[model samples]
Target: MTNVYLTARFPRIAFTKLETNGFTVDYYTGRDLISHSKLLRKVAKADFLITTLSTVVDSEIIDAAPNLKLIANFGAGFNNIDTEYAKSKGILVTNTPKVSTNSVCELTIGLMLALSHREVEGDQMMRKDGFPGWSPLYFLGHEIAGKELGIVGLGNIGSELAVKANALGMKASYFKPHQLSEDEEKAQNVTYKPFDELVKTSDFISINAPLTDENHHQFNAEVFDNMKDSAFLINVGRGPIVDEAALLKALKANKIAGAALDVYENEPVFDKKFTKLKNVILTPHIGNATVEARDAMAEIVADNVIWSSKGKEPKYVVNK
Candidate 1:
């Protein structure tokens, strides 16, 4: 039997299909994510390795797995894995994309509304202490309608956000490495702007870009200083895209109005300072936590492993 090692917990429904393909699949049975030491030992003899954003597939891990032929990532972003190193070792890498677009977009807009309306703060105060009755000026929040929204990435999730933002009476604009064609922009009802222009003008800035070497820490102290003091920042993208320390400084200084984030600079162990702030809304990277999306992700990753195991190319190869 071909040895296949999975570094994280996944849906068994998908694993059954891989099991039928004549591979002995193994995964972490612990309540928490598997540790790197444990993962190193498990993947030592793996023919195929299934990875997650939490797992770091560095050069050391790649070199240890002499039988490893493929690294099938569970999410759209593969930055966690060292693709360059993997390719140099003649291993294929694939990611499950498009399946979580709707799920992530919904979370992005939800965060926008949450930050604009101070939804989490209101709920927390209500649950912790009894209401002191109604007042003329109580629980005030910024209105979402008639606001300008700037999207940082115009990919699948960002484009969908624009469509939803327009329906909600917000002016949607975007800045991406690649600009859309005139016809595409007209259909989406989005205006293109330079990155600086987008930051300075938007009432709410949403980041939906992937983490890349060029744009890592894309939103820093300098970027925050350029933003409007009343603007809200929302990031449903990778954590490293925003500098955690800079974000903490901005929040403490009230440089921006407020911020909502689903991903953190150091994931699963984000800065403890974020919890003390009243103007921020933090989530545990649940941008694509919906059941439907996860099941589809499981199916896609399983398909990648199955196809590649048979010497056929997977559907979503990133390096090729």
Candidate 2:
């Protein structure tokens, strides 16, 4: 029987599935994976390891797990995992992709609506009994209907956002490494534009690109300067894609109307300065955090463990 170690709490469905297959599973929850050195010591003997973004699986950690056959990530982004080091040791790494697309896309739209309408601010004011009477300019916000929306990437989440934006009477334009086909363009009603042009012409900009070496700090002072003064920015993608310092400056200087972010450069540890700004809406990286998405991701991780244990191909192998 294979022994599996879960570095963080996952959906119970995964544990039940693995147990049904005669695998011994042990997990620790409600503890910080980074700060807990004893947990990694226990992980050293496990045959399969299931992890979340909170945990780091580097060369030293992988070396500790000599019996490890697989490392299954319970989310789409495996940026936390050291894939090169894992592959060098012939350890299979897998991630759950496309499962959380709709949930994340929905959150992106939610952030856009909330930021544009000042939803959070309004809610807080109402709760504090500060809503005296309706005034002509009471919480006046940017209009979303028939506005130009620029998407940084046109992948699953970005494309879904495009569809939703179109339905809300917005024109969709995207900038990606590759161009979309004519059929795809017509279906989503997305026009491919140059990055610079998209930044300059858009009334609202939403970033859905992945974090890569080329895309790191993709949004900086120059890009913010090109945006319209009334433009709003929303990022549902990786944190490091936008330079944190540049974003703070842009928001403070009113270079753009406002910004909404679900991820940050140093996630789970936000910049102290961001809390002081009222123009920005921040979420604790809950893009793919829906209950359904979490369960689906857990099932994917379980499938990877089962498949790898049986010498079969996993559904979403990252190392391969």
**Alpha carbon lDDT at 278, candidate 1:** 87
Candidate 1, poorest ten consecutive residues by summed lDDT: 5-14
| Candidate 2 lDDT by residue in tens digits, 1-320 | 68999987788899999999999998876655544475568777899999887677888888888899999988777888899899999998898889898898898888888888899888877888778788997779876888999999898888988999899999999999999899989988999999999999998999898778899999999999999998988988889999989989999999998899888888877788987887889898899998999999999999889988888988888887
Model 2: clashing residue pairs?
none
Positional deviation of 132 in candidate 1, in angstroms? 2.0
Tens digits of per-residue lDDT, candidate 1, 1-320, equal 78888887888766887888877899878877877788888888899998887788888898889999999998999988899999998999999889999999888888888888888988899999957989979888888899999999998899999999999999999999989999999999999999999999999999999988889999999999999999999989888899989988998998999999898887888888889998999898898898999999998888888888888999888976
- Candidate 2 least-lDDT 10 residues: 30-39
Predicted model with the maximum lDDT = 1
lDDT, candidate 2, equals 0.88
